[model samples]
Target: MAENIREHLRRLLSVPPGKGKPVFLFWLYFFLVITSYYLIKPVRDGLFLEHLGSGMLPWFYLLNTGLGLLVVCLYNQVRRRIRAVPFIQTIGCALILVFFGFRFLFGTFPALAASLFHSWASVYNLVVVLMFWSFADDFFSLDEGKRFFGFIGTGGVLGGVVGGWLAGLLAEILGSANLLIVSSGVLFLGLVVVQILGMAVPSRRGKGLADDQEGEQLGSGFGFASLYRSPYLRLIAVVVTLTMLCTTLLNLQFNRGVELAGFNGDELTSFFGSFYAWMNASALGLQVLVVGPVNRRFGPLPGLAVLPLICFGVFADGLFAASFSVLVLGYGAALSVLYSLNQSSRELLFIPLGIEEKYRAKAFIDVVFFRLGDSLAALAQLLLVSTALFGAAVLQVLGILVSLGWLITLRVLQRQTS
Candidate 1:
């Protein structure tokens, strides 16, 4: 009966029959961790934009990148010292403690508290999600990742939907400060889910990469220097950086729209939550219906090109008229498609590499380089919004140019792989 059920799900979700149990567990784990993050995400965004003020966003992104560097360094050190499961559990617990502290501080000095929480949340999102996917890369072969990552990602998107909805519903009742307390609980639940996955799934080292089976840990490699040495890695870096840059651009626009829309406090929280809920729902649908088939049928190059093509249209439209509704739809669609297909295709690029390259190089690329793009985009956004440097019209032009570059780079990346 279990085998029969697995076969049915294989047809439905496109997971291989042999991969059914572990993939399902991985999906559940992603759901828990993402739900935990999304629960606090609205609170973080509202507090940051409202209390810290939008003008300070560049500084926050810079701080996030700096902290990302530290986090990755410490993460590498910790991974060396402990097993993956225990390391993850310890980090999750520490993050919960930090959230508890944020809960207390937010009540006392909201502005300062929001700044701190915003920075922490920025780093937390990248670190936790990257770590999860790093483990995921270990679990699946290159072919398996192409086949099943979309289905696994669907779980995270659905979790985002639920978390966003719950946060919106509860924001007024519990208040933003107390939302931190709830997030702490949700994070703890994520750790418990990790424990469940650990018991059910075999260690990647035991069944994963051939090099990894020799039991050599990460950190022996040159890390960021490795990216410098390889043209292929350089292009991958550009693709990731550009993708994140566009995301940063959209985020600033979306937040500005929300602020202009005149929502504040719990209303702001609820609004942002609803916006995320809608975005994630779109993403979930795309991941379920389009991502896997697109990857398999059209290949990763087309998957890579999809966002730039969409953005070209969105931002080109932005050159003439800009409004709250336009920002909502345009930015949300860009985010949905990027996170759905583009993101899965991006990770697929790493699957063909060695474990060290897969993990260490990945940590740097995913965390540091990605955040570096974020920081630069934030700085650009700051200059535009604050100085009115050439105004929003010029920013839209810049986005169009960037999208073209993104398209060109996709071709370069495809050639390198070919």
Candidate 2:
């Protein structure tokens, strides 16, 4: 069994690229990544709210943030250490399969499917982000990235929508906990099949010139300092940090909005799951229509700057809607659409960066910076709630004002990158 597994991985790593097959494989794999996330996140957030309440949401986010940092920080070092593995993607595939397999065969023994799912979901979030973006960087050069990232990103949106709806529908039928386990088992089975027979990406198409080197140079124990040197990287970090604060608030509001309706447990899980699906659906439309065209026509800075402005609207409207169910839904809807635009456009920004900055530096920003922002916002949320310093409206006000400053920073960053 071990030898066959090794052989399967060997084949997956060595397959040659001809037409668009390599890119297609990337889409297929990343689609599964997002699907896994969508399946788990709604339930994770809903479960956290049900068990721990709004106070705990910040902590749960902090947990995710920490996990991302740990994985990304170890990534290069890990690959280098595993000299025998040769192909790290195979190791990832094996890990994915083994975990899922354990849940399936032993799910009845203890630690129900939902328990295993949560554990795996925690791991999956960081792994997928690192893998997919690394693959994206591998396949698309700086010049081509601008043209293709929007379209490629759609795979994630579609996967999110599918995963959310599936989890919700499954919850309605089998219960959230049960369905979560089933999703895990099913995901594992799918991965096993793919690992065994999935076409290998041709070696040449899958690696950058410097990809094989894993050392202290890029992002070792410390993250990429060169990213800090790039004007664009600084602005990207600032803008994303601001955006993270807004999203953190929005995420809390979402939980609170449901609580305002008086919900918890499985019912809350189902509703939030459905709500997430709807948001992804809305985001997909904006990605297709607004994100790419706007960037191509207006240039990268405006493409990038538009997000902070959208975040301003998101915060303003969400505050008003915080008290009203109808308004809250609209607020959620607007954020969904705007976030997609922000997401697609942000991926576009990676094209202009240097090589080390794109993979290592960006990974740091995604994990460390993102988590730092979330942690800060979460702490702020607690402090404000405890001290009664301000209501939702005040937080909204702060978010909008800071976003304006972020927009100015983004303009400067884009100019430096250009």
Candidate 3:
């Protein structure tokens, strides 16, 4: 009966024989990583909103962008010197310590802690998630990526659901600061999983690369220079930048709407938690029922196009009705799609690139360029709102315009990928 169940799961996830253990390990690794992030995400947002308020979000976004660059650059350097497993282990230990420190400081330095934690959380997710996918890109072949990435990504969606649910249930009972301890514990578990995975499947480098080469430094060149030389990477960077701009604008609007609804303290934390839970739950369903079949049948083009189209509709609706419920539904829908189909497809794009492109260049694109979009959005908000030159309607219009641009860029990317 147990063997039958295992066989069923293998069939459902399209896991070929001999690949089950590594796939399962990778799935569990991603599950723990995302679960850890979601566990603290609500707390991070709530503390920032409660102590700093929504108005200061732009400055925080800019600060995050600056810090993200420094962190990713340092990450790229370290990744070059160490093997993948030890590199991740070192980062994981440091992050656990930081979380513990934040928990201790929250009581005495609420504002200062909140400010620092907010920036750190933004960079943390990017670094951790990028590391996971970069390693996966190296480990899996292109054909395997298409067959298995959707199933692998489902682990993250499930983690988001579980983590979000726990955050909502525990915030009021355990207090927001205590959630950091839980998050750290979850991250430690992820590190354990990583160690086991390394022992199980030590050779994660691409074809023709020796296992020992995994520890050698990557080719000496800036990721930006590589990004500039490749038209494909350039297009990807632009599309990603646009996506983040839309996300940042929607987030600002969502936070304002939540504030208008008069939520604060634990109530605000719980609200954010519940919101993430519902969003991830929706994503979980789509990942199981939609992403794999769609990617297998129609290919990743549809996955690539879905979010921008959803954002276009959502932004257009916001022009007529900017209610809290509308923003909730709209933002939730966008994020659900983003995390499920869109995310899997994006990672699949990296599978065909060289190792340096996969690790160094991809890190730059995911971290620095990702935050570049947020910084631009924040700057736009600061300039327009502070000058009273435009209101929320203008931002909606901007989202609509950006969505159109995203669609156009995807077409170009499709041609190149084709």
Candidate 4:
């Protein structure tokens, strides 16, 4: 078994590097975006809490979040020829949302105008990230991914660590809105970097278009029908999606748990900074050590599905008996490791999927299904927090059900594999 695993690792890593031109460009532009958006990420969370205050009923925030996510999703689906079209679209939409909301609310609560502005700005940056990674996945071949994968992820990890630390330090001085402006400016720089890289070295990876193997051809709005046709890809998507949803539930609960434990403001922001940095850093570490090896140790499908199945019961505990310490120490650390491991391996396996599935279907899962999961979890929490129909105990029960669904999804995957 050990010998076989080593051989598998060799095959995965043996792929030749990208014509460093495109990969180089990707590295340069990708991390810059990290530095840019991360500049605001830590500070923004605190501000979001401040604005929402105790009044942030789950539905109220969830409703706006869902609504905003919908608009962002639509905008994301809209593609244009100008390569930079999406970047501009994201930033422009954020600007419009901020300006409109601020103008309407500034008179009544002038202080919060910038807060609202920064809040939406964070959304815009997230859209950029979701799209950028999808674009990278679409543009790079599996072989190319093997070579550049670690290096590319390394940039984001470093940027996040630095950005998180900066926010922790700058909370009172630069203020959250200023951090947002900085993040926005960094994003603008990212847009510029992508364009420069696009022109300097055009992407030479295979087009996302497909042959009859996938139900439809690519470049046709991600060939949605053909995308799901691959039972393999479909199962991957389901597992990948459920994992993402679990991540959201863990993250939201973790933060709320922190505050419930009586930490706030700069201290809270610092804690977040530490948490996010560790998560990203840990993912990078696993890519080097565990991910590829584990996938080879277990088949791709089983490797992909196993983590969440095992973790579901462990994580389900957070919904009920969770506290700030327990949340951070147990759920936060455990889930972060789980997420990082799952994401790294999932990326490895995704290389085998059809190109359309790689780009389009992956995009839908990353943004829509992923957010759909988050919104649903939020709704669940909303009901629990608000009415009498449910509670944290119910959330634990639901998580158990999702876990069972996870196990069944694995059976479906194994059947497809046969």
lDDT, residue 153, model 2: 73
Question: RMSD, each candidate, Å?
Answer: 3.8, 7.0, 3.7, 6.7
Instruction: Order the numbered candidates by TM-score, best leading.
Output: 3, 1, 2, 4
Enumerate residue pairs that collide in model 3. none
The TM-score values for the models, in the order shown, are 0.85, 0.77, 0.85, 0.74
Clashes of 4: 2
* Clash number by candidate, in order: 0, 0, 0, 2
lDDT of each: 0.79, 0.63, 0.85, 0.60
| Tens digit of per-residue lDDT, candidate 3, span 5-90 | 87888998788898888988999999999999999999999999999988889998898878877776687666655677888888
lDDT of 4 by residue, 1-418 (tens): 9767745644654633335556655676678677666665665566555555432534544664665676664654553323443455465456545544544564467447535544465565666676667567656767777677677776776677667766666656654455555565666666776666656655544434353324233433563564556667667667765665565556556556655666555565566666666656665676567766877787666656656664574566665555455556655455545655666666665566666567666655565566566677677776665577655567566666776787788778767766
State the number of backbone clashes in model 2.
Answer: 0
Deviating ranges (above 4 Å) for candidate 2? 1-17, 81-120, 132-152, 196-215, 220-224, 318-323, 330-339, 350-353, 356-360, 387-393, 411-418
lDDT of 1 by residue, 265-359 (tens): 89988887888898899988888788879889977888889888877777777777776687788888888888788887887898788876876
Off by over 4 Å in 4: 1-22, 54-57, 60-78, 85-122, 130-146, 188-192, 195-199, 202-234, 305-316, 319-321, 348-359
Pick by TM-score: 2 or 4, better one: 2
Top lDDT model: 3
Q: What does the lDDT read for residue 126 in candidate 1?
A: 71
